[model samples]
Target: MPAEQKSGAARALAELSDFSMKIARGQRMLDRVKDEHVQIATADKEIVFREDKTTLYRYKSTAERKVSVPVLVAYGQIGRYTMTDLQEDRSMLRNLLALGVDVYAVDWGSPSRSDRWLKFEDYVDVYLNDCIEFICREHGIEAINLLGICEGGVFSLCYAALNPERVKNLILTITPVDFHQDQAEGRVNHGLLNLWTRGMSDDDVDRLIEASGNLPGELTGYVFSQMTPGATLSKYNVGLLDTFDDEKKLLNFLRMEKWLADRPHHPGEAAKQLLINLYKNNEMIRGEFQLGERTVDLSDISMPVLNVYAKDDHIIPPKTTQALRDAVGTSDYQEIGLEGGHVGVFVSGKSQGVLAKGIVEWLSERDAPSARD
Candidate 1:
């Protein structure tokens, strides 16, 4: 071989060796991350109220409580509420606590065969209402702050609509209010959930619910994963490969993996209604959704609303959440569009500060002196 060619080949070999070393480092980091199995939602919390599968917990505060009305978080039934607190450094609840905000969360525990009959009415009017009342009575206040996530946002909207007097300021994060936007024309951004649920028939949903009693967590998890099938397929290996050399990033990734694996079974009645009425018919946004005997009118949500959503969220489209700004009855509605994906709304380091700061600023401004008295 020519002298120059030999030198080029040697350089190429050195480059390949460097990449191989990086991959090896990443593998070791992944092993450590897995073995650690870091526990999530690590902040100290006391279970303030319990109702069957539902448990409401108030996080023990380190900072003095600056806000009078404690913020109660209502999370989706599809996954663990711990997603908000996936890690200590990357936790949404911890950030709220650090901001001197009194934070509380409801754990919609995994349902059993006997919990098949749990409905939207049961969740909204019963369990959720009970939690709110508990907080209000504990604080000696008529109204408390309510923060709802995703499907829980639907419940919050309904709850605030029916019992507006109980919710001081409503905060909805990555909550999909306009279920029909995915089907609308000129919608450049849409989630696969809308596409999948639109095809589901009434009989199909009924039979599935009857057969399984509740929507199995695994099934729900699979559906969520399918939303980003390409990423789901490559996430474990590709993600670890990309971040394995960095212990911090790799460990955080594992924490997220554990949280994703902890899906909770959704109640059958609620699941059926969500599929049939909310997703398929898009009734919630149409002012036709009914919980028990009363209709859930979005206009009934008259409280000062803070709507937050991700710009690149594939799971919940921007239009889906942005719809609330105009649909709600309140003129005090404020919205901030941040750059992140669905889960990044809580987890991303850069995004968390933006999210936390926006929330604290908004809540502080609206926390009236009259509210405390």
Candidate 2:
């Protein structure tokens, strides 16, 4: 054979060998892997409180308690709180607990069609308030620190604003304050959710909720997948292939997939309020967003606020979260820009420590006797 043909043949043989090795490794991995190997949210915790579909959990940690006031972590109903405690090594909940923080997380359990009438008032006013009251009564303290993630951050803002006396310190992560900031800042890549919702009309939103009874998790997952179509494709293809040979990496991938697959249905009335009242009408920033009888005035939140946002967050948008600084009433407002995307803030190795540390230090500063009152 000619030299060119020989070189081509050698390249083909090398490719074939690499493919065969990958297949063998994948087969071995599949055979060895079990359901328990990919289990997520494995941190130990006991049920502290429960109401309807919501449950509050107090994490059991051997670390010395540093802060006197406990923290109630409220994650948005869109996704489960398990993302924070994804795994033993990559868990923000564990990271905080290891740092001597009294951590409590609220799990907004799966909502069914019967929960269609449930609104933000039920979440913020009823469920969240009950959890806070329970924590206060248990600790014999007037108030506790509040850590809100994503949509939960919005609920926190509403709660802190409405009942400022009940919240000692407020920490918001990857939360959207000004929903329209994306268009105002002219960021094409950011706030796809905001833009998509804005494109929707009031009638369209109502019709959606009416037809579906509640916003389906699968539908929301599809929408999220649509946000980054290429990445979504690459995640299961190139991403899965790369992890097939490595047990640890493969487990990590599976854990995340588990979390992603567990999106909960957002209640219909709440979904309508979120998509129309907040996203389209821009009511929250305007001090017009209503929860029950009270409007959520951002300026009413007088507590020391620590606003954390992911620098590369595409869903919430950096500007959308940063908008909280000026809108909030507190003079002691501080912002920490972490190095990651929306979910990466909790899952990324580099960010896990930074996020938990930032929260601990911020809480400790305000948690002092003088500040606590």
Candidate 3:
């Protein structure tokens, strides 16, 4: 054979070897991995309170409690709270515990057709209020820190606004304040959901709820997947291929897939409010959003506020999250822009430390008596 042909043959052989090695690694993974081996949200915790479809948990920690006020992490119904505790090393909850911050989280359990009548008022005023009261009684503290993620941040905003005395410090992550701000600053790629929702009329939204009873998790998942179709396609192909040969990275990817597969159904009435009242009408920013009978005026949130947003967040644009700055009642409000996308703020190794450390320091500062005074 000529030199060029020999080099080509060698390259083809190298490719074949690489393919065979990947197949062997995949086989090994399939043979050894079990359901138990791919577990997530495995941090030790005890249920402190439970309602119809909501449960509040307090994580066990060996580190001495440094912040006097405990933090109650509230994530929205669209996604499970597992993202914060996706794995052992990458868990934001674990990071807080290690830093001596007493951590508690609420799990808005899976809602069914029977829960179609559930509204934002039920979540914010009734269930969330009960959780806060439970934490306050347990700690013998008048107020506990509130850390809200995504839709849960909206709940926290309403709760803190209605009962500011009960929340010592309010922290919002990837939460949209001005639902209409998606188009602001001329950023087109961000807030696909916002645009999608605005395009619908009130009748369309009502009809959707009437027909579906609840916003199905699978449908929402599909919409999100559509937002990044390229990533969705490459995720199973190129993304999975890259991790096929590495057990640790492969397991991490599987864990995230497990989390992604667990999106929860958003109750019908709440879904309507989310889509029409907030997203379409832009009520949250206008101070016209109604939770039960009372309006969720963002200005009512008078506690020390820390608004955290993903700098590259597409779902909730930085401008949307930052809108809270002018809307809130607190003069001590602060914003920390993390280096990641929406969920990346929680899972990405690069941004998780910045998130955890920022929370700890912010909470510690306001947690002190002098700072509070």
Candidate 4:
């Protein structure tokens, strides 16, 4: 054999040896991995406001200083807000704080059996406004910035529409608003949510929510797992075996798994409205989504808007979020398409850099005196 060929063969054999040893080591560590618990959402925060199961947390400025107006982060009630702060180094919350951005996040704490009757109106109208008003009052500002993700983005849109005077800028990520849009049009891939809900009737929605009181978190996790069944099985079966030797990679993967497995049950009344009113009837875009006595009009949100969606998002597909520009009342609306799947856009190291940098630049430019006044 040639000298180059011999060297190449030697290198390949070395890698194979390493791979085999790593898998063996990983297999031994498998049982021990069950006892490992990594803490999350470890940023410094104070309870600025609390009502029943809901609490709004204001993160202390870790940077030298912060923006004049604070930004409130509203995460989906379907899951814990801790995903944004997945770990110490990879947390979006910590990254934002390091960039001199004042941040607050709402925690719709895990609900109970008696809390079944809690409606969407309670979440959007009462709890949302309560937090917003408190933030504005505490900061001594008229209007502050609002950042919403997923179902929380829906709440931010409704709140901004209902009380435009309290929101200076609106930032939404991975929020599905226009549920009625044709699934096959302008999409890299058709959304599973659209397909799943399209066939579900009002009775079907009511039947599920009514029987269970709240939509079970386990069921939600199962549905998400089914989205990529092969990948799901591989994680527990083979994927971890291959990766377990790399401590950092294994830890991060396990952290994500921990979060995914900790899903929160959806409030029954809100789940019903989400399925029947928003998902089935597509009420949000049509100005039929009601909170209290009034329909939520997206056009009422006349503030600077930053809409972001992942191009490869299977849950809330890019087309679903990109449609916001047409319905929005603000001429200052902007859109950004990140190159990855939905959750990966936030937690993955490469995309987290892009997301944080994009947001910091977007908000920094608009952080003038006029933005608050």
Candidate 1 worst ten-residue window by lDDT = 182-191
Off by over 4 Å in 4: 1-20, 28-37, 186-189, 369-373
Against the true structure, what is every candidate's RMSD? 2.1, 1.6, 2.0, 3.7
For residues 1-373, could you state the per-residue lDDT of candidate 4 as single tens digits?
9999999999999999988888788766655565345666778999988999999999988887546678899998677889999988788888889888989999999987778988888988899889988987776788888999999999899899998988889999999888866374666345766778778887888888888799988988988888777888888768777667676677777888889989999999888888788888889988888987888999998999999998788888777788889998989989999988878888888776788778888988888533334
Tens digits of lDDT, candidate 2, 32-112: 989988888889899989998889999997599998789899999889999998988899999999999888999889999
> How many backbone clashes does every candidate have?
1, 0, 0, 0
Ranking the candidates on lDDT from highest down gives 3, 2, 1, 4
Give per-residue lDDT, candidate 2, residue 245. Answer: 73
What digit string (tens of lDDT, one per residue) describes model 3 on residues 170-285?
99999999998897878778889999999999999889888879999998999999999899989987898888778889889999999999989999999999999899998989
| Candidate models: Cα lDDT each | 0.86, 0.90, 0.91, 0.84
Measured with C-alpha atoms, the lDDT of residue 138 in candidate 1 is: 86
State the lDDT at 45 in candidate 2.
93
Residue 183 accuracy (lDDT) in model 1: 39
The local lDDT score (0 to 100) that residue 346 gets in candidate 3 is 94
Off by over 4 Å in 3: 369-373
Off by over 4 Å in 1: 31-37, 183-189, 369-373
The TM-score, computed over Cα atoms with residue i paired to residue i, of candidate 4 is 0.91
